[model samples]
Target: MSTTINSFNGDQQQSSSSPDVGDLEKHYIDAKAFILSATTKDGINLYDHLAHCISQLLADQPREGTDLVEDISKTIKSEATPAQHDTLRDRPAPDSEHSLAAEQKPLFEKVDHSEELDDEALQSPLPHILEQAYYFEQAGIGLGKDESYRIWLALKQLADKGQIDKLRFWGKIFGTQKNYFIAEAEQNVDDETDENELHEEAHISDDNRHPNEEEMDDEEDMLPKSTYKPPPVVPKEERGTGANKYTYYVCNHPGGVWVKLPIVTPAQISQARLIKHYFTGDLNKEITSYPAYPGTERNYLRAQVARISATSSVSPAGKFKFSEVN
Candidate 1:
């Protein structure tokens, strides 16, 4: 019988009223206030339009490690040169175009107490919310919003509609997770030491030897049973033995490596190719042969193979570097 295959995506049913943001409502309201008052009644103007777009993008999800309130605005960028976002920096953090002679209500202070707002709100203004989303999407960084909870809920709803059990649903969602191997056609085995130890340790008197022969004939399971062969556990310095990098992340069998090269501009690509040529000299006669590293990491290869690719200029300085400062 042909069986029907189904999938779940319950987040689509969520509206602004959804409970996921219950605790965040106050922040949401305050943010909405800033956005609404920042623009005119026609909310669809570039100001509100961008905010709505980004808010919608993030509305249904939470980033892995990002605080929505903290990172949201920085990600927005106006589609203007050097960054039309600079306009927001000039005024009280409003996008430059929106900064007119209009009376500005400071969002940072509580009107009654007359307290000074923190410098964070003052200096780090998010010019346009939509611009941040656009730039982030273009930059190819993970939209680090957290949607795991909602996604899990979506899966639950799916199982209910399909009349499926938890195990079956898990199997369907992630394919069967085999955490054993078949011992010929009749048996399967688990991997543990004592239960799997050979009969050599059966050091008793010889009286029971021949009669118990049949028991020793049975197949035994070994610990660390058949798994995908992992990379060779070599010391860090052993890496890049014959290559440029002395250390690298292993992503494949025996000796795999993963390197990330910037793919932001053509000039960067050209530079990358040149670096590759420099490292992997031409085939003795060509005078300019591209270098070929041992593994299959595109970023690593690009660094030494293709110099003139548009993958290195997008993020520079502190914005795109992949290091965490203490």
Candidate 2:
């Protein structure tokens, strides 16, 4: 035998599954507040039209096996219209704009003293306040009447806010913070290093060593403090026996033959090609004509190599020529 589904009437039996109308109305009010807070009105009426649909949905329950809340929510959302949905989606929450404005006010506007006002009137200006106002008004380094007014207003605000004591404290130390005339005590790096070294030395002891620490210490002691040594200067007679100790370009002029050109600056490398132009018209053509060569042999100009070593110093004390070398 086949059985057919039977429909029952719950409202007539006083046992409907639908939520109470009062509860639905309360939810509608809260939902309206949330939607209105984030969005402006569109073509659809959000509250009146939505409330009407909600009332209908609550009074008439959905068919069998349907969700009561989901059906009511769907009915309410349908009233929003497509245009209203777009507006709600595009707009930010009203509370967010208000909070951003409050945060920016402190940075752009003068400090607020409304809290301390407490319905009381502002006090008369003190003697020091008038003096400061007068000084600013009269002194002509761009402190005009506007600045004077601002100063007076700030002072009055401070007094009204019960922050006059703080203002006085800051005034006492005016222009002293990080100023050249104020000598702030500074820590010396060398002194700190010496103190740290002393502390480390004081802590060092034979008893403090681990089992492998003695071996590490012995290895450290065997090693030299530094492995570096300056390259040995080759004798002038034995120019290329090993790598050239120091390469120099000797000046070809008879008066400046003793002078050796050293690539002391970065500019000399760049100006190598421009050497001809630099010395073409000058009396020092002999010195500038020769391009740089390695290993101390004079160019085709017959200039002798001046060997650079510890015993020798550059000739023509103040006559060193500089060039831009790439």
Candidate 3:
């Protein structure tokens, strides 16, 4: 994930007043770490604070940065309504034409800043940030709806260093309502914790607090979670391939938890060669590989190479040569 931030330094400078390359890298790297640690209650509050800061930065005009104190000083003296002052205090005027209220659309809106970048930033920094933010969340960073917006702000700043239309650019991440789902899932998990606590309280009187229960709690806290077992591989008939069809490989995941690659027959590769494109066989059968780290699930890793690893090869595992795929 940190490597993703490093790619920003390679971007061509878009503006003289743009954020320094080193500064951008440091901020994003720090922000990624901050998000990953934000699952606790205090951690969540700190995350929202960072999101608020990012929102303030987005509201400011290009290169001016956010100056809420000065803006409020001027607002108090002007004839602006109390409501207008409140709004300005939160967000500066957007680079594009839109009211502050409209600019703050729900997180899943169709807005994207990648289209606003020059070729270099578009192809490089912009995508790098998006990919990092995505995997960061998938790695159980647990970025809820609110924290996810910080990702939007970061991308917008990278795209048009001096200008971003808050309204026009306001859209959902990856064009999906995933943030909504993530928020709902978090709420459900939190509710379960509360329910468990209530159950414990109802059963235990003040004088009868079980020493065994306390010991169990401490033991549970000390123990690490077990290895995640993915759903049993149920090979689909249509996508099935003979064991000898193509060279098979597993992700060289550092933790030694790896999945079989979906069978791509030599015939399929041959046809793809003639067409000069990768073949999308049985699009529904794609198998995706998630970040190969502890505590991450393969299912949670979206946009992974899901298609290739649909079924395990019939050939003996760990018997293939890397040169065969080449």
Q: Pick the lDDT winner.
A: 2
Worst 10 residues of 1 by lDDT: 179-188
Tens-digit per-residue lDDT, 226-316, candidate 3: 5786654343222223322222122211112123233232323323323322222222233332222111122212112223333322667
* Per-candidate TM-score against the hidden true structure: 0.12, 0.16, 0.15
Q: Model 3: runs farther than 4 Å from truth?
A: 1-118, 121-124, 162-326
How would you encode candidate 1's per-residue C-alpha lDDT over 1-326 as one tens digit per residue?
12322222333445444766666888888877776667543233445556654785567576543556445443443322142334344435666335421212222223352668776423321123244445666788522233222222233322222212121101011112211110001011221123211221242223234435455456485345355766533322211222212111111111111112212222223344454322221112223335432222233333333221223326556676557788
Give the better candidate number (2 or 3) by TM-score.
2
lDDT of each: 0.31, 0.37, 0.36
Determine which window of 10 residues in candidate 3 has minimal summed lDDT: 180-189
Candidate 2 on 199-271: residue-level lDDT in tens? 4334443434446746757774565446576564332222222212222322211111122222121123233
**Clash count, one per candidate:** 30, 11, 14
10 residues in a row with least lDDT, candidate 2: 176-185
